[model samples]
Target: MALVELGRFNRNEAHILIGRLDSEGVVAIPFDGEASIGDGSYLFIAVRVLVDEDDLATAKAIVESAA
Candidate 1:
C-alpha cells in the first residue's frame, strides 16, 4: 500500500465507521488508537484505509456518510 491518509478519526467515530467500511469491502489498517481526544485519559482509535488512489474519494465519502 502507498500509505495514503484516508482520514483522521477518533475512537468513537472509528468504532462506528470501521464496520460500515468493512461492509463496503474497503480494506482498513488502524494506524493508532492510543491518543485521547479530550483532556481525559481515555484512548482513541485512528485508522487508515488502504484504498486505491482512485477510490480515495469514494472511501472518504463512505466515512463521511456514516458520520
Candidate 2:
C-alpha cells in the first residue's frame, strides 16, 4: 500500500500520533525520527507521520478530533 504523510511533528508527538492511529486500527509509521542525530539535532527535525493512502481520510478525521 502507498503511504501518505498525515502530518509532521516532533519525535515524541509523532510516536504518540502513531499510537493513537494504531488504537483506531489504522496502521501508521514515523519517518525521519533519527535524522540529524549525528549532530544531536534530531529534535530540530520534524518527524513525519504516515498512513496507508486508503486510510488517509479516516486518519485525518481521527487526528482532527484529537486536536
Candidate 3:
C-alpha cells in the first residue's frame, strides 16, 4: 500500500487530527513522530499522519491549516 505523510504533529495535536480524520471517514494512522537518540534509536511519543496514496492531497490540505 502506498502511504503519504501529511504532517509532523505533536502528540496531542496528532491525536486531535486523527480524531478529525476519523470523523471524515478517512483511513489514517499515526507514524514516526519523535526525536532520534544515539545509535540510530528513535523516540516516538508524538505522531505523524499517514494516509493512503489517494488521501495524500486531502490529508495535506487538512493539516496544512492545522499547523
The estimated TM-scores of all candidates read 0.62, 0.96, 0.67
Range of the 10 consecutive residues with the lowest summed lDDT in candidate 1:
42-51
Cα distance off (Å), candidate 2, residue 56: 0.2
Model 1 misplaced stretches (Cα beyond 4 Å): 35-54
Best by lDDT: 2
Stronger candidate by lDDT (1 vs 2): 2
lDDT of 2 by residue, 1-67 (tens): 9999999998888898899999999999889998899999999999999999999999999989989
Ranking by lDDT: 2, 3, 1
Q: Compose the digit string of candidate 3's lDDT tens values, residues 1-67.
A: 7988776777778878988887877778887644553545454445778889998877777767665
CA displacement after TM-score superposition, residue 47 of candidate 3 (Å):
2.1
Sort all candidates by TM-score, best to worst. 2, 3, 1
Candidate 1's error at 20, in angstroms?
0.9
- Listed per model in order, the count of residue pairs whose N, CA or C atoms clash below 3 Å is 0, 0, 0
